[model samples]
Target: MKGRRRWRGEHRRFAAVLVLYTLLLLLLVPYALDYGARRGRADEEPLLRRCPSLEEALSEWGWEQRPPLDEEEEEEDEAGTAGAAGNGSAGAAGKRHIYLHATWRTGSSFLGELFNQHPDVFYLYEPMWHLWQALYPGDALSLQGALRDMLRALFRCDFSVLRLYAAPPAPRDPLAPAPPAADNLTTASIFGWRTNKVICSPPLCPAAPRTRGEIGLVDGAACEEKCPPRALRELEAECRKYPVVVIKDVRLLELGALLPLLREPGLNLRVVQLFRDPRAVHNSRLKARQALLRESVQVLRSRHRAEPRGSPRHQQQHLLLPPGLLGGGRASQPQHRAEFFLGGALEVICQAWLRDLLLARRAPGWLRRRYTQLRYEDLVREPRAELRRLLRFAGLTVPPALEDFVLNMTRGAAYSSDRPFLISARDAREAVHAWRERLSRQQVRQVEAACGEAMSILAYPLSSGDAR
Candidate 1:
């Protein structure tokens, strides 16, 4: 009996050890996989070696002085077999890929439109938005991975790959009929502005009979007729042909997450980070809440009109009312949408601005050189000078057409945060400091208190009365 008892105890102990081992393996596997992937990428690409240091990289901008290249380095350069294939002017083909990274309410739309107006640029707006919706409420790491993968495919002009992760299965009520299967739609068609622009742009598609004012109302048939037989193939070909490909996304404030792409050899990427004053950002977000509320009301009204009364369609509309509508408490709604646009507008904007600025400052030298920081104030105040600086950073000569585009876009339009769609150069200088008149003293103080460190780093002065 004693021997049998001892055997049973040993068996229990072995089982416990095995269970613990399994749990530990589960815990560590993700980290291990991530590390391995990063290691593989580093091994495959050695673009960082060519940069040497941040100071040397910035020396090209005439920001600082550095020693000239040594005789050996010059010889290596002349032999046409020097550093990485994507280094300085020698490696820079006319082709470049640019990313404009910013947070919402930072005048990013205007900045994006600047690139969109460039004839040589194949500009994309917010391609990762669908991914965000599909992978609703994922953990930060998972979301980052999804975003990175989507961007990789996009920059490579592999549009079909997006369909794999673009739309997840929508939840259905057991009482109602099954939701419709999601179709494979091109990224441009998924976004309203992009859909209109793609249909109208002569290079991307043959122009339809649409006036500038009526461009946004283009029908599906018109777009389909103009689009190439294979949208993805044609887009990829265009990407190759264009001198520059620009992607503007406000969701890419976390600079650390994109370091790998900056170092990617094939991409030859550059970044323009746009920032606006926190007070202005906060005020703009508050104003935007009204716009969002109106949009939600419109959506509700449209649903009511489309669905028959008391039918499943109408019932589902009530049960799963869109987010920020009638205060429905659906987890999926919050998961898929930005809360900043709903409530606590000032707090969210201030915190995001501070966090993003800190993350950007911590980026390594090589990565930093690839980024050019532009203040909304500066860009609006001196459009031509800022445009020149931006083009220079991208290693492109300022063409007459580009200058004309800038002037035409901004020359006579009023500045309003609410009207991002309108391109106007009118009263641009006044918009820079308009926050002073728009925000209350208490509001400005609140913003300053939350973002004091970032404000200091960016050289934005605190108001005299609000100074701590």
Candidate 2:
């Protein structure tokens, strides 16, 4: 009996020790997860490395090193200056390239259209779309590099070269399953445009074929006939002839990554940084997530009906569905995907806005001169005035045609934000403040908590509770 009691006591002591160890691990788990997340974010973003000495320049925008102008570019600049001195038309001769920097769901499509509609402006809508597809869901740094490199090529009018870096669209059969969002390389997926405007544009292709309506589609015959591969010299000449080239990309929220391009010689680079209310941005992103999820399910279902159930094609289609799209062997609802993918939506949007704003604020005077910051609210509130300012900044005259286009574009009843391709100014005023109704008080608070400082800097007022 004494031996039995001693053994039982020893066992009880061991059990207690095991329980204590488990409790300790549970207590430390959250902190450990948080540390890992922070470390991962640091590795992914590395904002400090991208813009060294950010603290010193936070108060005032300054650069550590100025990009040196190459000898050839310097000579070209001098020649351009001399020509400007002799003729008043020299300003027209100097081509302007504008970068519309924005974040997702910030009304960038509308802003891009404003430039695209202009006759003199050769607008490339989201050239970085290819880059995103090429580096889909990769490290943030790699995406940034791809964005910069692609922009460099596009600005230089090197269309043939971009193909090297960008992935070719994957082959699809009528019965094949739609690729996951990351792998989808349709024209709309790769170029962010429903039409092949960039490929068929006058700068890259012959102008005569552009008159045909069907040329807008990316048909092989139309491309071969209209966009016969031009030599580099011819492409460059066409680019020089254009007064302005506008490239709008929402992925270019990282202003620091674009500093090098701002300093590129001969090519005049200007930036229009567009921002929207953080709450609105978050809400729009959620809505977009839902739309994407719905579209994915429909496509998957259609593909399922077309292909044999147990065939290799069906199996391939099943595999193509991203994990986010699938839940328990079936397509998940949009809300489920949104919740799973974007649980911290408010924080993510706020952080992105803050980072972009901070980077733009710290830009040097030279870059700042070329940079224009516009709010979506402002654009919607006074479309005419804001557009005039934009045109002036872009060095484009407000022609009567442009004025009419703006008026019609903003006032049309057919205009809806949901339809990206359709140019409509309908409900412009309401769209600016729609977030008030869409975002819950809790959601607003979350955004305000993460972005209070940025909001203040950008002149966005916070609720009393959210005020710093």
Candidate 3:
């Protein structure tokens, strides 16, 4: 009896040990997989990774002495050729993909229009907006991978990805006929499709006619009223016909998130990053505050979740900045919810811009050739000259009609504030500098405090009051 009792006790102990071991494996396996994935991840490295070259360059050259575009191009060209042997596959494909990387109220629409008006380029305006809309309340950081995947598919003229988010699934029971079909996505499902030149013009829509060698903007209102929605497959066919595909998006917050797409050899991807004065961007964001509130919240949520108090990197980033810059529960304040969320988002934006600037400054030779940065102020001030430089970088020659259109658009009759979001010709100079008149001194100071480091790098001088 004593021996049998001892055997039962040992069996219970062995079973308990087995259960604990199984639980540990279940928990540790996922963590191991995640760690391994991160180790091999091709996206941007840690934002705060030390770059000795960047530090030395900044100390020696000062902020205002950026290498001239021409000089930089020459250097990149010389270095790019060493790796050109492997790039022939993409070149032979005869499809060049460009992403206009910009955020809200940064003259991005105007910049995107430059490609949209080009007859040989198929431009998609904010297609990823569908993803953000479909996944509402999803943080911007979390959705970046999805954004890249969507871009990958779109660049290849594959419209099937759109169905994943654009169309709601049909009901399981066909006889009920209560819900929309799974394959119901159409041209109109795209964000800003009415203004898309390819969608508004021939083959897809008969609302506006296209002629050979024509470079003109599409009429959004007319397209909306007269054009019938076409199937997603039709848009895909039209996309395949173009040699250049340009996608403009404001949701991509960091250059690191996009490095994978940039490194993909088959895509032949190039990036044109557009930047505006932070103050001006903030002012415009406030003007459209209600419309941008959701996106602002999304961005702020990302910053909060990404930066934890225990992190050494997070501590270093906040050491110099003022308190509340991270928007910690600011949504609960007495101020407008839009202002609170937008304010926090601005800090994140500056952080991203500063990081991107540093990364670009120290980028490898091949990446340097593939990436170029543009300032909205400079582009507006020298429309013709800047346009030529921009076209050159994209491997495109300037057509006389496009040049004339750009000049006319910048030299508008007068500056109008009535329709801030509408894409129309405006007095570029006045529009660029309007922040001086609109923002309060305190507001300006806040922006300078948040963006001083980036503003300095971009050669935007501090206000006379702040003086460094």
Candidate 4:
């Protein structure tokens, strides 16, 4: 009887310990989950942060607070005096190339169409995107992710190309399934193309002798003519006159990879950074209504929340980025309409202002000097003056035709005014203060909260003459 009682007591004690351990784990599970989530997700903290910490910059408009950008006048002088850029007469041989660098919904398409007005510019519309999607599929990335990889891949590879929409030698189908063993980032046999001209690979074809320029999109030299003659002739003709080529598609925002082409000795390049009020941009996005807008909004929201003044380290440490940071999807809904128009719109404004503010604070002088900010409102208000400013910036003459084109377009007398030109009624009403009337009083506050840095950058004063 004594032995039996002792055994039962010991067993009960063990059971109690087991129960306690289980309960402890249960109690600790939420924290463990949070830790794991923080570790796993790059944007977990900002995702949780309410009212992004952007207010710190508000007191000084991010300009006063930031260190001044240093100029590289010497670098340009050295290049000019030392003949670093081909006897200091860049493109004197008539190799004119124009580049348009636009952020989303900033009237890029309209600008592209307008640029096409130049008798010389061919203005190819996003040719590289589809081909990029085809050539490199990775296991870790979605198909779209693979496309971005292909874009980055160009930096390491020969960049020569025919139609960027079609890969060299032609894949069986541009939209085929990604290859086996395809983790989203690794090259797959099907998606990966080997060419030393493109990157580190054996010769794509022996007859070609692996030249180190534009990556060929086909297997042979004769294939150079394979791209539609109309296209090539148009491009060549444009270069003959303007020497600079530009495609004003906001879609090409990731085109830093195209810098190699611009840097070549034969081309003189200027990139125009154009943008508009976010609500107008949101209106354009509204028209583009795509199902992916939800994801895009979530992404933009997170991006806006990240890198708040006090949290640069957090953003860098967490690797936080907007969805558009890597690439963009789309969104089309009333709320999303409101998101971009209202919420997403503020984020875009922040980005544009922040980019200019940051670049002014950090980039080299020539680049800073070379960069031009063309707000759509400025164009709308004074098209001739703005056009002249643009011409002067681009080192082009103030041609009568160009001036007339601007006059005609702004007067609502030219080229399909029926189609919205990426502006809201309010956008036409006021440049910075347009949001005041469009959004509800509460809605305005939400935007204010979201866009806490406005008073400093856009000259938006403190909210409410009285309400605060």
Candidate 5:
């Protein structure tokens, strides 16, 4: 009996040590990852961040910087055979790059606004798109160093979203003793608008939601007496201390072709795909281009006639219900089907959209698993529910402050018509149905026939008329 008791005690001791060992490994992992990444040699190490280095991420889309390559860099380029490959110089871990994959007019602006409100989220008003909108029209030259600075801004904003995780920037209390090297990091105004694209917003005039291609100067003379290189080095050193960061831009969805160049596996990014029904989308699109919407109506009508019914590649086919059916079918107006106007360039857009969705669905399972899908209906109707899900998706907690704000904001929602769709439970359910009233009968039929496969997959009904 004495020997048996002694043996049991020995086993218990071994188990306790094993548990402690596992705990130690768990606690040290992030630090180990953080340390190994930052301290590694710069020349050969690939920085592992979540954001990709794409042309959209660059100041110039697809324009390679012709920095008078130093003899050594030129030799490296020759050995690599082209500029297509990048040197392993910028390897940092956990850099979050967020691309809002959304169709135009899908309440994307509102979504952007929500993200911008997060104190930690460095809200960029379409960082990658200035090249096409402001810079190109203004004919700004994309120089090598300027381009580098542009990337630095992208990187800084990308990392700043990990606001609490990383150490705060220097000069926090400039008079105090400097923080430890392990705890320091650098962030530029791109994280804080160090250099922002000069938006020509008329006083109180809501800036048009589009990128302007103009050469934007570093705001307030980053050019005049810029922070010293040694200071920047110190900043990078501190930045390296954190394991992860995040950056967001909605324009990447507009320029879908630029995706490959932007994907950076070293960054460990999680991509989000957001979408909304087309009629609402088109309505908003029309609103944004009032004159064009007026002109396009005639064109849209003519184009609507050319497409055949019962064929594939249509938009908003199944969700249409008569106006009488709206609001528990109480109102007196006859609701028409939205798919009735489903052809021409509109059809083209719808079809292209479906294609992108399919491609996004099939993206490498690795990226696909990381990709999250959110419909406008889900978010607007139950902001708290949706936000909670999103927090879990991002592995974040639903802090009390955010929870309180979301709860209050969603309680007495008035989103429809003006905000529309997002505020009402009926609109949320009938979101895709807007096409019934918005589109012609033929347009509805044609779109239904065309996109039946995708509709089924997305769990949309075929048509309201089928019930009759």
Candidate 6:
């Protein structure tokens, strides 16, 4: 009986020991993982480590706090400098190539449409869409080279560069399952090509092509029905007929990425960067969260892949580094996967914008002359004045019809929520402030936290926990 009692006592002690061990493991595992992560990141540069302070950036860029950007004065100054702005190595060519450098949901479509309406401009909407779709699941950084090459080719009116991403022909039936890969890319493969003025109008389509230079919207379905798929070579032929070529894309993240194309003597590239309030952008992104998931994942992928430590490439890429240390905690899965990724991508975008702001501030005279910045709020608030300035910058004159179109497009009936991605008319003011009503306080705070640096520089006021 004594032996049996001793055995029971020993069993209780063992159970107590096992419980203690399990509790110890539970406590230590998280710390162990965190320590490992910190050690791994020790060699990697923190995203903000290399970024200069706002004061430093502003000082180096030669600007005071919130200095007004008077375009007329700047233009006069640029004109006085002999070879500052418009003069490139290929200044003799007298051709203008404009890249609408913007990210998604920044009202870039509306801006691109302005150029598309101009008779002198041949516009392509997201030509890089083909590259992105063909190389889906590839990180954004890995595709920058191909994007640059493709842009160079497209600017020169060479369509063969697209052949690199060509896939099998699309199915004849509309309902047929799309080939597991992206649809075959031809002249028609460019995203939103159906609405492209040049593609939908004469010589390409029989649809009573709208009057030349008439500022109007194209019905995509009607255009698709009227216009048959043309060969890529034919598209190239059409591209060369215009004096100005404008391509709008959201894929190009960094301004520095375009430095090579900017320096090319054959293409006199002018960059117009568009920015929107980060909170508004974040709200719109959430509204279309699911659609943006894949791209967001691809963008966030770059942050995880560490470059060679202390290499020149590593140092160079820091400017474009997606947010590394800021908000770099493991994403919780309680929310939809898309929301998490979209939020993370927004952080990446803000970091990118901060870098661009710094780079532009310190850019040389020639580059400064070629670059222009536009805000969505400013564009909508004063469409006519802004449009005039934009046209002058592009070396084109604004027409009354274009002016009327801009006015009507921004003064629509309401901000339509059903078709978030549609490029239809809407009240621009309402659209700009929609975030105040839509985003929860928490959501606003999160975006503010992530984009605080860029917002401050751009003069965007932060929320006061009262964003109902």
| lDDT of candidate 1 over 235-348, digit per residue (tens) | 567666666677887544245456667666567677898888876776665555554432223222223222223334432322222234446455446422433223233333
**Residue range with the least summed lDDT across 10 consecutive positions in model 3:** 82-91
- Where does model 3 exceed 4 Å of error? 1-93, 168-177, 207-213, 305-335, 466-468
What are the clash counts of all predictions, listed in order?
Answer: 2, 2, 0, 30, 50, 0
Candidate 5 global lDDT: 0.42
TM-score of each: 0.62, 0.63, 0.75, 0.50, 0.45, 0.73
Best by TM-score: 3
What digit string (tens of lDDT, one per residue) describes model 5 on residues 113-188?
4443343233354444333232332211222233334434445533332232234345668799875453234333
Best-performing candidate as measured by lDDT: 3
Span of ten consecutive residues with least summed lDDT in model 2: 299-308
**Candidate 6, residues 1-468: lDDT per residue as tens digits?**
999999999999999999999999999999999999999989774334454443343344343223222557445534533332244222223577899999988899889999989877889888887788889888876787788889898888887776667565579999998774533346576647778888888877656467546678988888888888877777888888887889899997777678777765457788999999998898888788778888888777764332212334433322312233234553344244567677777777787788788778766666777789999999999999999888777766667898999999889999864877778778988988999999877678778877887899888999878786
lDDT of 2 by residue, 1-468 (tens): 999999999999999999999999998999999999999977773334443334433323234367435557645654664464345342543777789988667788778877766656667777765555565444343356667877887887766545554545555686776544432223333344333354455546555355322212334456556565444455456556666788888655357677678777667787898988776676666667764333223222233222223335532422222244544543366465554344243343444456566666655556666788999888877788898788777767555665666666556553256654344566666666566767666656756655566788789888654322
Answer with 2 or 4, whichever has the higher lDDT. 2
Per-residue accuracy of model 3 over 1-468 as CA lDDT, tens digit each: 999999999999999999999999999999999988887875745323464433433333233233223456556543443333234221233567899999999999999988887766788889898788889899887888889989999999998988788776556887966766658778886858878877887766654665424777777788888779998888888888776788999998776667777766668788999999998898888888878888988888887543323435543343222234445644354345567678778877887787678878867666788889999988888988988777666655567898998988898866655777788888988888778888777678888877888899999987775312
- TM-score-better candidate, 3 vs 4: 3
Clashing pairs in 3: none
Please write out the lDDT profile of model 4 over residues 361-410, one tens digit for every residue: 44444445445667777776787898767655544444566667666555
The 10 consecutive residues of candidate 1 with the worst lDDT sum are 55-64
The alpha-carbon lDDT assigned to residue 102 of candidate 2 equals 81
Q: Over the full model, what C-alpha lDDT does candidate 6 score relative to the true structure? A: 0.75
* Model 4 segments more than 4 A misplaced: 1-96, 120-122, 128-241, 252-267, 291-349, 413-418, 421-437, 452-455, 458-468
